[model samples]
Target: MVVQTTNNYNASSGELWPLLFNSKMDDKKPCYLLCGLPKPLECRLPDKQGGVGSTRECVSDKGTIQQRITEWVPGHKLSFQLVKTDLYFGPCVESIIEQFVITDNNQGGCQITRTTTFKAKGPLSLVVAIPMFIGLKAIHRYVFSNWKRLSH
Candidate 1:
């Protein structure tokens, strides 16, 4: 199943995309703490060349999520494939695809959309989707809100 959420920000895609790519620019506190990496998170910034095929890993608590950049377009879009994850429901999750899209809006700012595609192992695994999406939505909103605020 695919879950998508979009939020409008009072910032241009040019302003937000660069921050998303720059590891040093992210200083917002993470909201989700149940299944992701532990406290002080460390991320490696992707190389230039559009960052395609670059990977980012996060380790927290006792879990870790490793994501690879599958597609990247500066000031436009970024997509990732969940290469590995040891989260709360890792065994039930078959695969995941995450994407972010930024586009200019008529409101003079930009619209940022986050899309996550999840493949479950079976019917029981599908049941876990609800809570997973709820947690994800919260984290996304928190991150986007911080991004918007920082863009000012």
Candidate 2:
């Protein structure tokens, strides 16, 4: 299953990409907690200098998840796949891949599209698909709002 969201900003992709990739998840206050999940205590991304193959680790009291960068295109696109996760939801989720693409608009701004693909563990895991989609959409909105606010 996939959940996608998009938002436009009055800033260039170059201006907004850094805001999303160069910051800690805790600072962004990722919206997972709003979905009845534990808040991440720390989210350590690789140095902004790394490109593809770089890794990021997010830790919460519940557990930690590590992601590997699969694609990187500076100000245009960034994508990663979940490599390992010990979080509570790991048992129900098999895999996750997320991508963010930014493109210039005719209005002299940029639009960012975030897509998240999810693979459930089994038939039983389908039960939570709706909630997962809702949570992911909320997370994307929260992140986009933060980026828009900070781009100025």
Clashes of 2: 0
- Each prediction's TM-score versus the true structure: 0.77, 0.83
In candidate 1, clashing pairs total 4
For model 2, how does the per-residue alpha-carbon lDDT over 1-152 read when each residue is reduced to its tens digit? 99999899999888977765654343545563565664555456756465789986656667888889899898999888899998777878888999989999888999999999998887877787777887778767766776677788
What residue pairs clash in candidate 1, if any at all? 37-59, 37-60, 38-60, 38-61
Q: How far is candidate 2 from the true structure (C-alpha RMSD, Å)?
A: 2.8
What lDDT score goes with residue 76 in model 2? Answer: 93
For residues 1-152, write the lDDT of model 1, one tens digit per residue: 77788988888788888656543325545564555523323334445434788875545445767889998888999888888876766887888898989999899899989898987777777587776776667656666666666688
The best candidate in terms of TM-score:
2
Candidates' C-alpha lDDT: 0.71, 0.78
Model 2 pairs in collision: none
Give the Cα error of residue 148 in candidate 1, in Å: 1.6
